[model samples]
Target: MAEESRKIIHVDMDAFYASVEQLDNPELKGKPLAVGGGGARGVVAAASYEARKFGVHSAMSGQLARKKCPELIFVSPRFNRYREISHSIREIFFEYTDLVEPLSLDEAYLDVSQNKTGMPSATLLAREIRQRILKTTGLTASAGISVNKFLAKIASDVNKPNGQKTIPPEEVHDFLMQLEVRKFFGVGKVTAEKMYRLGIFTGADLHSKDEDFLTTHFGNSGAHYYKVVRGIHNSPVQPSRIPKSIGAERTFRENLSSEIFMLEKLEGIAEELEKRLGSKDRAGKTITLKIKYSDFQLQTRSHTGGHFVSKKAEILAIARELLYQQPLRESVRLLGISLSNLNTEQDSSAPAAEDVSVQLRFDF
Candidate 1:
């Protein structure tokens, strides 16, 4: 089974949030548009290609984005409408195979080794799915077809914003050897810097290292890197698709040096997060606060309490306290508030008082 060829496809919506805004407001099409909560403290949700040309991008502060692109238009995110479109896309996928693993509202991975449609070629299946998405939802999606998730994900971006690419088995080696190390999964800013310092700037450089040497430097993650460098990734496609939590955050245009500014940002994030939780009819026992410094250093603190917290005030209070407790040398450039340890079973559906007090443990 491990040696057999696998049929994997990665589908990603093009400029998802910004595109949705343009779709609903036809006049905004082909213009620079940014989807974000509008406030001095709000963060960008997405930036259109015209906006990108001006250096505007997601996670950027609205103020900075405006400075970069003075004509950048801001539109608020409409998640319900986005969700409606997402559901339609999911329905299209189910027509081909149930082995669809959604990464988010805008991206998914499908395993079509043995598809419901009895298709012999995964590339053909990818094209059909892309066409169906466009016919049904007035939107464009890019797809990548390969033998595994890693290759498929990279191939998908080769020709983006409404394009498809395929990497057959014969071309896998040449494709991987020339691939940049930064494009490898799990290699973010910090990891990429470390790889560069070690003279492993590309996949070819990484492949030249002894596996044991990589393990010594990076532990378990190094093993992942080593295998990927050799074009060997066997992770399974997971499709159960239940979200464990939901949250939102923002990055400041300039470093936030004052508590007043930070708290204000936290309040807006908490409000948005609570709205999402309320819509899902979910509550969480754990609240987490994430901070990222200007240097890209990141830290997080989480608290698990007895009460299920769904109120904005409660979340903000906890986040503020966490922010205060952190020892800082540099000003914070980004702030994130999240809730986990979720209890999604309906409160009414739960057991009696004694049962309500019972704690469930997951061994995984």
Candidate 2:
């Protein structure tokens, strides 16, 4: 028998944190608002549509955001409340389809080709799901329906808040061919510039390049570019996607030049890492150390162990080696550590903890 055609829907909440705040507080409606920490080093976590008009966006520094929109009201994020609402929304999704893949607390992809309601139209199902989310959580969501994940995800962004878009399989090729190269999933600013120089500015241009040409120019990613331009993405909506890495990072108020001070800061970061690992009961074989210089140059060093390391001593041992092996080029402003190649399976034995109170007596 021939295989069944796929139906994927990507659901994204509209400015989730800001919308939740507006729903809970009547006065915040129709005003420009941002949910974030408000300080010298603070960053915006979410921005309302009204705020977005002035070029405010997430990950932008609060200082610059204020400069862009002086009236932007900043509110601290209520993570617990957001999580509660996200749980309610997920329950609604499961009512329609068990094949749900959560991208974050406020977004997910659902395979609704074979749904609980036995509905044959994925577009109608998307509308129903959006309406249910609004009715249940008092917050609106946007949706995109397509034959695969990539197109569906992009479609969700077409009609802003509280809207849905569906791309029939028959229209997929035309839709992609007319789309801009910069709009493709993995294409960023640098890649777009390279494409422009190579005279590949649109999806049609990307499609025109042969597999060998793309591969020779872009390495492995060229293959992905070649396939996606033709609407050939087949990656599934995985329901059990585990996190590949966990990390903690901090930006200092003052750049430090002393190796002694940097090591002290790294020790605090390692302790936090241990606590996080213990909470998740996860260990990883790879340890990475990241640093940002005062001039904004970034550098990283990593080492992979034979076995997983989650305990404080084990993490610090590898982290310390990575730090000392590289000499500082300038004053450092940011530092971070991460663990990857994780072991998420339940381990029968408990991780042993040890204290290593070594002072920074040596200098590079």
Candidate 3:
């Protein structure tokens, strides 16, 4: 099928977890709140805007959050409630377009180029959707409208906390030229520092480099930087959710019964996990080790902490403890290591600024 212009919109709810708590309980509104525990070992899952003013944020230790905001209130996470609301929000997206790719419970990408309502203006569509979300859920959402996913995602951050931004078709070039490299979608702290060393401080600086130069310094990710700076992202919004966990598992044909042998296999599994995490520069505090016995009985052990770890050595050290935490009921047939609680829950990698030629105009 021949395609015309593309209109991608990224909608992100405002402090989804904390907001939901506030909606259900009127007392939590307009106060510094963290949706986790207030105990010394508690890890924060989310924070409200009031809490953000005091430097409290998600994934931080609850002890630190309390230190940052003395009056901050902490509540246990209600994941089932969150999932329920997230389902309702997705229903709203399906009403607009079928190309709904959920990044998490709080955000999604909508391809509205050919929408159900036949709206010609992506900007207006975003506004309408945000309004609908606010009316139905009693919560606010921010949206970004652009010709592709990359620009759309970044644009959404420009005006946040119940606001929206649009990068019109003709304005894409200038926007990229003026953007800071640090704000580019995939550029994390480590990548940004490396780019700075190469004297690439902004989109204009990144656009000046050739693919070869970037590839040499950054490996495969450099090619991504080169294309993104030139408004050339071509990845589409797939209709699925961002992965909840990333893992590597191995099945042994011989059903090893020895713990020593399991340790050897775990080292190799950890190596694969490091590669997966490094690919996206993601770090997480939660690690789970899955054990499948010869009899097909499955068991899982998990540990979560305040700091994030992405190295093989760090991951293997934890996996080793979980393996010896108890006696194996039977010979193990499969062993796996998975990491969750990632820092990049809201991060997405692709969305083209337009067709490669930039000839397609996003209709209004």
Candidate 4:
């Protein structure tokens, strides 16, 4: 089975955006820098290692970051330049194997089980790829080598900033058992909090729970929790891991009772979805609308057999329709729109751009 024989390597760029800016401009090197427009409303896009030392990080409010590090140097993100470097790294990965699954502009999963170079060891290949990225892009990358995607991704993060780690097949269970539940891929802040309240703080705690019990508590994702706790993921390293859906949701600072305001927020989300679909050369047959109400209750509505929707107007129209079909039972805090049943061929035909798209589907 390709799943069982999989040789996955997770490659992560070190401080991707910030590193690129520093590389191109010597003045920014060895300084605390963040990539984003700096203002009261602006947030950090990428933080240099120096800035990280000051506890600054991406998605942190720009105003808050300024308060944390008063001397922080702010630079607007050069996405075009970052994309250029991302492209270069993508080419380098393909040179080793075409089974490349990019997670983001700065990270990717490469399945080199059967590589172009006929390399028998994926670890050696990961080392070579890291070196090549440094030479060509003037940037450092970290890598993790394992038999599966889950272990490989965790290994990559274990050694930070220009390092590599490997977890052998025999050590998978032990490695996972020692990990904190919060560090698990699928465990977000909300989920982690729930797990904490349940007295499950580590992978070991999760492993102790029966599969049926977890499923009863966490729903479908609980089954995933059971497998990941034992390092038993069976998902493949898909070569064309294209976006099957595009959607955005916001957790409200305060829950809204107005249906009109919720619809207005959905409009913004629809526009964002439209732009994303237009930017990527793919069409979808399904439009899914998700709403999370104030009580944390979640529900999704989807429409199928839709047109080859590439334009925002069409996508929004469908999403709006699906959204209205359901009643808001409680005050809503989050809304999202997604297009699924993808057309991969459309994406492959697009002009190749760099910066791997890293999609962290923690739900598996």
| TM-scores of the models, in the order given | 0.77, 0.87, 0.72, 0.78
Runs in model 1 deviating more than 4 A are: 37-39, 242-288, 292-298, 302-325, 329-364
lDDT by residue for model 4 over 224-326, one digit each (tens)?
A: 8987787767666777776767666665666788877877887788788777777787678888888877655789999887456857678777877887796
lDDT of 2 at 88: 98
* Residue 117 lDDT (model 4): 94
Candidate 4 has an lDDT of 0.82
Could you arrange the candidates by TM-score from highest to lowest?
2, 4, 1, 3
| Candidate 4 ranges with C-alpha deviation above 4 Å | 1-3, 247-337, 341-364
Q: lDDT (0-100) at residue 162 of candidate 3?
A: 94
Candidate 2 backbone collisions, by pair: none
lDDT value for model 2? 0.88
Identify the leading candidate in terms of lDDT: 3
> In terms of TM-score, which candidate is strongest?
2
Note the residue pairs that clash in candidate 1: none
At residue 174, candidate 2 shows an lDDT of 85
Query: Residue 283's C-alpha lDDT in candidate 3?
Result: 82
Give the deviation of candidate 2 from the true structure as CA RMSD.
Answer: 11.3
Model 4 TM-score (2 dp): 0.78
Question: What digit string (tens of lDDT, one per residue) describes model 2 on residues 98-119?
Answer: 9999999999999987899988
